[model samples]
Target: MDKNKNHVSIWCIVSLTSIPLIMTLGNSMLIPVLPILEDKVGITSFQSSMIITSYSVAAIFLIPVAGYLSDRFGRKVVILPSLILALIGGLIAGFASWKMDDPYTMIIIGRIIQGIGAAGAMPIVLPLVGDLYQDDDEKISSTLGIIETSNTFGKVLSPILGSVFAAILWFLPFFSISALSLISIALIFFFVKVPKDKDEPLKFKQFIRNTKEVFKDEGRWLYTVFLNGVLVMLILFSMLFFLSENLEKVHDIKGIKKGFVLAIPLLLLCISSYISGRKIKGDLSRIKKIIVVSLIAMSISIVFVGYTSKKLILLLIVTSIVGIAIGALLPALDTIITDNIRKELRGTVSSFYSSARFIGVAAGPPIMSLVMKNYLNISYITAGILGLILLLFVFKFIKVDEIGKSKEPA
Candidate 1:
C-alpha cells in the first residue's frame, strides 16, 4: 500500500463521486427531455426510448469485458481511456441532439459510445476503491459505504439538477455530463494513485477462467441476488418512466413541472440513503433482512404507483416508498459485493454485477413501454412478478452470513 497516499482528498472523492454522477445524471436528466425528442423528432415511443436504451445496451454487452480489462491492465489505464470516451461520446450526442434534424439515430450511436465509456468507468470504480485502500479494512468498509451514498446521491440529485439545467436549456444536461466526465478524468490523473497490481499478466484464456472462478465461490450467489436487486431497481425506474410518460401524454405536463413530478420519488431516495449510511455497522443477517424488506417495499410501491395513476397523492406517496427502498438496497448490495469478493478479483466481479444491472436497465424500458402502450396494468403486474421472483431467489441463493469469512484480518 502507498502510505504516502492521502486517503481523504477532496479531489479523490470528487473523482470517485464523478463516476456515478456521470453514469446517473445523463439518464435522470434525459427523462424529462425524452418527451421533447418525441415531440420534435416525430419518433415512435420505442424509438424515443432508444436514446436511453442504447447506452445500457452497450453497457450490458461490454461492462464485463471492461471490468476484466481494468483488472488486468491497471485501474487507471482502463478508467482514463473510459473518461475520454465518455467526453467524446457526450460531446457528439450533445452536438447531434443540437444539430441533426433526424437526431435519434445519431444520438443512439453517440449513446452507445457513451455507454461503452461508462461501462469502463462504473463497474471499475468500486473495485478501484477496494484496490486503492487494500490494507485498511475499516477504511475500505467506510469508503464502500460512502461510494454507495454517492451513487444514490447521484440518482437523487441528478434529475433535479438536470431539471434545473434543462429549464435553462434542453441541451444543458449533455454538456453537464461531458463536463463531469472531464473532471473525473482530471481527478484520477492527479490525486488517486493506487499502485498497480503485480499479478501474472492476464491472458485471454485466463480471463475466461477467472470469470468462471467468481461464480464458484459460495458467496457469489449473494452477488447474483444483488444483480436481481438491481433488476428490481430497473423495474422501479421503468414504472417511473411509464408514469412520467403518462403524465405528459395523458395529463398534459411539459418541461420543468414535468421534471419535478418525476423527481419526487428521488427525494425519498435521498432521505433514505442518508439514513442507511448511518446504520452501516450492523451484522450481515440484519443487513440481508433490510435488503429483503426493502425489495418487498419497492415491489409494493411499484404496484401502488401503477394503480394510482389517477390519484396523484397516492402516486407520490408510493413513489417515495419506492425511492426509500432503492436508497437502502443499493448500498447494501455494494457492500455485499465488495466485502465478499477477493481484492484482486473485485473489479471483475463488480463488472459482472454491473453487466447484470445494465442488462436490466437496457431491457426494462422498451419492454415496459411496449406493455403500457397496449395494456398498462401488465406493466405493474410485471414489476410485481419480478419482485416476487427476486424474493424467491434471495431465499434460494444468497448466503449473506458466510460472506464475511472472506474478509482479510484487521
Candidate 2:
C-alpha cells in the first residue's frame, strides 16, 4: 500500500467526527431532563429512565444488521439513510410534545425510531475509520482517540445543552436534537468519501464460516475486549445516571446548574481520552498496561463513591477519577479490535463489539434506578467488583503479540 494513499483528508475528519458527536447529543442530552420529565409529564422515576433505555434497546437489536449491510454495500450508503431516519424520529417526538396534551407515549415511540437510526450511524464509524487508513496503525489509533474524544466531548456538552433548551420548554431538547441531526446529515452526505467496496459479498453460510474462523483463532483476546467494552460503557452510563438523579434529589440542583455539575467529570473524561488515544499508538503492550492500571483506579474510585455520598465535592472528585479511568480504557479497546481485524470482516466484527457496548448503555440507567431505590451503596460496590473481574480477564487472557497475527483457523 502506498503511504501517500493513507493520508487522511480534512473533510474526512470533519464528516466522520460529526457522527459520534451527534449520536451522543441525541442520547445523553436526555439525562439532565429526567427529573423535569417526572413533573411535566407525570411519569415515575423508572419511567423517566425508559426515555434513555428505549433508544438504546432499538439500537442494540438493529446495529448488527446495519453492520452487515455496510459490509455488503458501503459505509456512506448505509449512514446517510440512518441519519435521515434519526431526524424524522426527532421531529416526531418534538411535534408531539409541542401539540399534544400528554405526549409521553409518543415521545417513547419517537425515541425508538431514533435508536433504530442510531444503530446504523455511530456503530459503523470504527470500521469506516479502519477502512480510511488501512495501512497506517498510528493514524488509526490517533483517529480512534479523536473519535472517542468527540464522543466524550458530546457528553460534556449534552447536559448543558439539554438544560438550556429545557429551561425554555420541557420539549425543546427534542427539537434541538432534530436540528443537529439535519446538519450532520448534510455534512456526511457532501464531504465523507468512503472508498468503494470491490470484494464479492459472501453467502450467508460462507460468511458465518468466516466469522467463526476469525473468532476461533482470535477469540482468546477478542472476546475479552468485547466484554470489557460492555463493562466500560455499563459503568460509565450507570454512574452518570446515578449522579444526575442524586444532584437533583439530594442537593436541590436542577436545570443548567445541574448540567454544569454533570459536565465536571465528563470534561475530565474527554481530556483523558484524547491523551490516551494518542499515546497508545498501536502498541499492544501499552494498551495492556493502561487497561490494568485504569481498571484498578476505577474500582477504587467507585468504591469510594459508595462511602462519600454525603460530601458532594468528595463524590465529584471520585467520579472524576472514574471518568479518567474509563477515558483511558476506551481507546485502548478500540485500538485492539480495529488493529486486529481483517479489513473485509472489520465492519461486522466491530459492529458486534459495538452492539455489546450498546447493551450496557441500554441497561445502565434502569439498573441504576432500581439500585438507587433499594440501596445506593450496592450500585457502587457492584461496579467495583465488575471492574476487578474485567481486570482479571485482561491479565489472564489478553496477549499483546498474539493479536493481529496469523490467518483464521480453518
Candidate 3:
C-alpha cells in the first residue's frame, strides 16, 4: 500500500472503528447501574439482567441477517440505518425513564430495538474492514486489533461512565447512548468510504449454496473459531457482570469508586488486545499458539478468581490475568476466521461468528447471576473448565499451514 493510500485507509479505519466503541458503551454502560435500576424499578436481579440480555438477544438473532444484507446491499447502506435505529431506541428508553411511572417494560422494548440496530452496525464492521485491505493480512490483523481494542476500551469506560451518569440521574445513560450513536452515525457517513461491491451480488439461493460449500470445506477450524469466539465473550462479560455486582453488593462500593475498581481488569484487557492484535500478524502457528497458551492461563486464573473472591485484591489480580488471556485470544480468532474465508463470504461467515458471540454475551449475565446467587465458585469453576475444553479442542483440531492456510476438512 502506498503512503497516501495507507493514510486514507487509516482514516477510514478510525471512523469505522467508532461503531463498536459506541455500541459497547450503549450496552456495557448499564452494568454498574443495574443495581440502581432494580431499586428504582422494583425489579428482581434477573429482571435487571434482562436489561442487558434483551439487547444481546436481539443482536444474536439479527446479526447474521445484517451480515447477509450488508453483502447483498452495501455496508454503508446497512450501517447508516442501523445507527438511526439505535438512536431512536435510545430516545425511547430515555423518554420512558424520564416520564413513565412504570418504565421497565418500555426500557426493555427500547433495548430490543437498540439490539436490532446493533446487529447491523458492529457485526458488519469486521467484514467491512476486511473489504478495505483485501490483500494485506497484516494490515487487517492490526486494524481488527485496533477495532477490538476500541471495543475493550469501551468496556473500560463503561463502568465509570455508567456510574457517573446514573449518579446524576438514573436515566442519563440512555440519553447518553442516543447522543453517542448520533455522533457515530455522522462519523461513518462522512469518513468511512468502502470500496464499491465489484462481484455480482449472489442470489439468495446461490449465496446459500456457496455458504454451504465453504463450510463443508472448512467446517472444523471454522466451527472451532465460532465456539472459541462465543466462549471468550461469555467469560469476559460474565466475569464483568459478576465483578460489578460483587463490588457493589459485597464490598459496599458504588458509583464512580466502583467504576474505577471495575476499570482495572478491563484496562489490562484493552492493552493486551491491542498488543496481541498487532503481534499475531496473520501467522497461523502464532495464532494457534497464542490461543492455546491464553486459554490455559485463563483457565487457571478463573479458577483462582473463584477461590479468591473473599479477598478483593487477590480477586482483582486473578481477574486481570483472565483479562489478559481473553484479550490475547480474541484478535487471533478474528484473524483466523477472516483470513481463511473468501472475501465474498467474509460478511456472512464473520456474522455467524459475531452472532455466536452475542449468544455468549446474552447468556452470561443471567446465568452468572444465578450461579453467583447459589454458588459463586460454580461460576468461575465452570468458566475455567470451559476454557480447558476449548484448549483441548484447539490442540486436537486447529491445524494450519506455515503460511497460515487452513487444511481442508476430512
Candidate 4:
C-alpha cells in the first residue's frame, strides 16, 4: 500500500478529487435554482424538492450495489461509465425542460437517471481513497480531507453558479451538469491511475457474507457513522432549501444576491472541512472528540436557530456555525470508517455509508418543505434532538479498540 502511495501523482489526486466535486455539483447546484424551477415548470415547492430527492433516492438504493461492483471490477471502471451516464441524464433534463410544455415529469426522470449515475460515482471515491493509502492512517485522513474539502467547495460554488446559470436560463444549470461531468470524466480518464486489485474477486455471495460479518463486529461504529451521515446531509440540504425559499419569499432577496447569501455558510464549511481534515492526522481519539464536539455544536446551532428571532443576519451566523460543525466532523467520519475496514470490504461498507448520507439529502428539502408549510421551528428542534441522540451513541459504543488500530489491517 505504501508502495502505491509513492507513485501517486497530482493529476490522480485532482482527478479523484474531481469526482466528488462533480457529483456534488450535479446534485447541490440545483438547490439555489429550485425556486426558479418552481416558477418555470409551474411546480410546487414540494415538487421542486422532489427533483433533489429523486436523484438522491435513486442513488440511495444503488450505491451499495456500485460499491460491490467497484470492489470487483475496479473504481475507474465504475466511475468512467457513471460520469457518461450523468452527462446523458443532464442532457435529458435540460432538453426536456426546454421543449416540453410541462417538463416536470421528464425532468424528474432525468434526475433519476442522474441519481443512478451518482450512486455509482460518489460513494466509490471513499473506498478508492482508502485503497490508495491502505496502511497509512495519516495520509488517508489528510487526502480524504482534500477530497472532502473539494466536496464542500462544490457546495460553496453550487449556489452562485446555479444562480448564474439560472440567469442565463432556468434549465441551463442542468446542462452545466453535463459540462462538469465531461470535465471530470476527461480528468479521470487521462490522468488518474487507480491501483488494480490483485486479489481474486470475491463472489457475490461471499461479498454479502463479508459485509454481514463487518457489521457483526463493527456494527456499533458503523451504524453511528450511517446515522450521522443521514443527519448531516439532512441538516445541510434542509437549511439550503429553507434559505433559498426564505430569502426569496420573506426577505425579497433573489438572483445573485440570494446566491451569495446561500454561499456564505458553505464557504465557511469548505474552509473548515479542509482545516479539520488536515488537523486530525489519523488519531483515533482525536477523531472521536471531533465527532462528539461537532455533533454537540450542530445540535446547539440548530436549536439556537429554532428558538431565536428570525432576523436574516442571525440566521446566517447560526447557519454558518452549523456548516463549520459539519465540516469539522466529516473527515473524521470518513477516516474512522474507511481506515477501520479491510480493503476487500471497504468499498461495500463505504457505499452503505454513502447511501445513508444520501437518505438525508433525499429527505431534507422535502422534509423542510412539509414543515415550512406548517411550522419551521419544529424541524430544527427535531434535527437537534436527533444529533444529541447520535452523540450519546458515539460516546458509548464506538468500540475504538477494535476499530481504531493505527496502520494495521483489520
Candidate 5:
C-alpha cells in the first residue's frame, strides 16, 4: 500500500460503490417492469425482451474495450462519461415512453445506449479498487466486499423499487435510472480520487503482449477465478429465478409479499459478503476454505431444494444457505484476482473477470427457464455438478504464498 496515499473518505467509497449499485439497479429494475413496458408500448413480449437483451449484449461486448480504455486513460475518466451516457439513455427511454405513441423502437435504442455506457462503468471498478489499495489485500478485499454487497442489495431492492415507481407512473423507473446515475456522476466527480498513474504507459502492442503473457503464466489460477465468478453468479441467479417462479406459480405469492420472500436469501448474501470479507482479511488459505465450503453447501442445499421446493418454508431455508455460500465465496474470488494482478494490468484482467460475471448473470434466467420446464431434480443436480467442477480447480490450482507476496505474472 502507498504509505503516502491520502486517507480515503466515506464519500469516496460511496462514490465508487454507487457505480455498481446504480448499474445493477439500472438493469435489473427493468425486469419486473417488462410486463408494464409490453402493455404501455403496445409491443409484443418479444419486443419488450429486446429492451433487456439489447443492453446486456452491448455491455458484454464492450466491457473489454472499456477496461483497456481505463487502462490507457484513467478509471474516473471512463466512469464519469459512461455515467453521462447512461443518463442520456435513461432520459431517452423515459421520454419515448412518456410522450410517443410508438415508443418501442426508441426505448430499445436508449437501452442499447445505456448498455454501451454500462460496459465502461461498473466492470472497471474491481481494478480501480485494486489501484487504490495496492498491496493492501485486506482493504481491497473488504472494500470489494462492500461493493459486491451493494450490487446484491440492488438486486434485492429491484423488484420493490420497480413496483413502487411503476405504481405512481409506469415510466417512472426509466427516469429513476437517470436520477441514480446523476447522483453517482456527481459523487464521483466531487469525491473519488483515483491513484495517480506512475507506470510509463504501455504501447497498444506491448499492452496486448503484456496481457497475453499474464494469461500464459497465471492462466491456471486466473481462469479458475474467472470461472469462479461465472459459476457463482450463474448458480446464484438461476436459483433465485427458479425460486421466484416457484413462489408465484406454486405458492400464489405475488406483489410486495413475493418481493419480501425473495429478499430472505439475497439479504443472507449481503450479510455473508460483508462478514466473510472482514474475516478473510487477505488470507488466501482462508479464502480457499471459504470457497470450498460455499461451493459444497450451495450444491447440497440446492439439490435438497429439488426435493423440498414444494414446501415454501423449507425451500427458503435451503436456498438461503446457498445465498450465504455465494456471499462468502465471491469476495474470496475477488481477492485472489485483485491481490495477485499487477496494478498496470489490473484493469484489463479484471475486465475479463467482469465480463465472465456478466455472462453468468445473463445466462442464469434462460437456463433456469429451460431447466425448470423439464425434469427439475435432474437440473438441480446438473447445476451442482458445475459447482463441484469449480471446486476441483480451487483445490488444485488456487495456491498462493501464505507470507503475502504475490506471484505476479511477469
Candidate 6:
C-alpha cells in the first residue's frame, strides 16, 4: 500500500465527508421545521411538503446530466461550482424565511437551486473519491463509509438543531445550513484535488452512443440493485416525515425535544453505517445476499413503526433496525454498482444511481402522506409491500452470480 494511498489526510477525508453532511443537513434540518413553516409561512401541509420535493425534483432532472458533464468536463469543475450554488441557495432560502416574510415560494426556489447544486456536489463526490483511490478497493469503501457517516451524522443532528433553532427563531435553521455551505465551499477549494480521466472527452452525440453501448449489455442485477437503493431512500424519507410529524402532534413534543426524537433513527443509522462499511463483502454474490436481508429488515422495521402507538422506546427500536438496514444497504449496494461500471463512465453511472435515489426522495413523503391520510395503516403496509416486491424482483430478474463479474462496456 502506498503510504500516501491510505493517507488521504483526516482533514481531506473530513472535507470530502462534509459535502454530504452539508447536503443531508439541508434535508434533515427541514423535517422538524416543516410544521413550524406551515404555521409561519401560512401554507397548507402540501405546500410545505413541496419544500422537500423541490430539492429532489431538481436532483432527479439534473444529476444524470451533471454526472455526464463531470465525466467529460472533470469532477472539480462540477463540484466547486455546485458548492457555490449550494451556498447561494442557502442564502436565498435563509433570507426569504428571515427578512422577506413571504410565502414558501421563495424558499422553494432556493431549494430548487440547492437541488441543482446538489446534483453536482453529492453524486460527483463518490466518483471523485474513486478517481483518487483507483487501486485500493478497501480504502475507497472506507472513504465512502466516512462520507456516508458524515451524511447520516448530519441527518442525526439536523432535526435536533432545527428544533432548537425553531425555539429561538423559525429561520435559524436555514441560516445554520447556510453557514455550513459557506464553510464547505471554502474547504473544497482548499483541499480537494480533481483527477483527470485519460480517455477522450465525450461529446453529446458520442455520450449517447456510449450510453447505448452500455445499455445493450447492462446487467439485470444492476437495475434490481438500483431500484432497491431507490426504495430504501423512499422508505427512509417516509420514516423521517412520519416520525417528525407524529412526535410534534401526537406526542406533543416541541423544540429540541421534538428534534431529539427525530434524531433517534439518524443516530442509529450513523452507528450502523460505520459497522456496515467495514464489514462489506467484496464478492458480489455475498453482497447480494446482504442486500436481500437488509431489504427485509428495512420492511419489517418500517411496518413496525406504523403499527406502534405513542411509545417512544418501541419507535426507537424500530428506527434503529431501519438504520441498520440502511447502513448496510448503501455502501454495499454502491460498491456493487461501482465495481460493475467502467471507470471511464463512473460519474455518469453514479449520477444515474443518485437520480434513482432522488426520485425516491421526491416521491416518498408526499405519497406516504397521501396514503396515511386515506388509511392510517397504509403507509407501513405500502412500504412493506414495496420492500417485498423489491426483494422478489431481485430474485426473479437478476442472476445472483452475474453482478460485478464483467465491466460494463461504454
lDDT by residue for model 2 over 283-372, one digit each (tens)? 889999999999999887888876776689998999999999989888998888887888777888888898888888988899888888
Winning model by lDDT: 4
> What does the lDDT read for residue 140 in candidate 2?
92
Candidates sorted by lDDT, best first: 4, 2, 3, 5, 6, 1
Candidate 6 Cα errors over 4 Å, as ranges:
1-7, 397-400, 405-410
* TM-score against native, each model: 0.91, 0.97, 0.96, 0.97, 0.91, 0.94
Model 4 residue pairs with clashes: none
What is the C-alpha lDDT profile of model 6 across 59-109, one tens digit per residue? Answer: 899999899988888887898889888878878888998888674788999
* Global lDDT scores for all candidate models: 0.73, 0.88, 0.88, 0.89, 0.81, 0.80
Predicted candidate 4 versus true structure: per-residue lDDT over 1-410, tens digit per residue: 54555466888899988988988999899998998898888989999999999999999999999998999889889989998989999999999999999999999999999999999998898889888766777888999999999999999999999999999888999999999899999998999777667789888898788777778878888898999999999999998898899889878899988899999999999999999999989898899999999999999898766544358888899999999999998898998888888888888888999999999999999999998756788878888999999999998888667674322334
Q: How many backbone clashes does candidate 5 have?
A: 0
lDDT per residue for candidate 3 within 250-356, as digits (tens), equals 88889899999999999999999999999998788899999999999998888877688778999899999999988888888888877777777788999999999
> Which has the higher TM-score value, candidate number 1 or candidate number 4?
4
Q: Superposing all C-alpha atoms, what RMSD in Å does each candidate have to the true structure?
A: 2.8, 1.4, 2.2, 1.7, 2.6, 2.0
lDDT of 1 by residue, 111-177 (tens): 8888989889878887887776665655665666677677767766765676677778776777788
TM-score (C-alpha) between model 6 and the true structure: 0.94
Name the candidate, 1 or 6, with the larger TM-score value. 6
Give the CA lDDT, 0 to 100, for residue 399 in model 1.
71
Model 2 residue 217 CA deviation (Å) reads 1.2
Q: Which clashing pairs does model 3 show? A: none
Candidate 1 stretches greater than 4 Å from native: 1-6, 135-137, 196-207, 219-223, 404-410
Off by over 4 Å in 2: 1-3, 406-410
Worst 10 contiguous positions by lDDT, candidate 4? 401-410
Report clash pairs, candidate 5.
Answer: none
Candidate 1 vs candidate 5: the TM-score winner is: 5
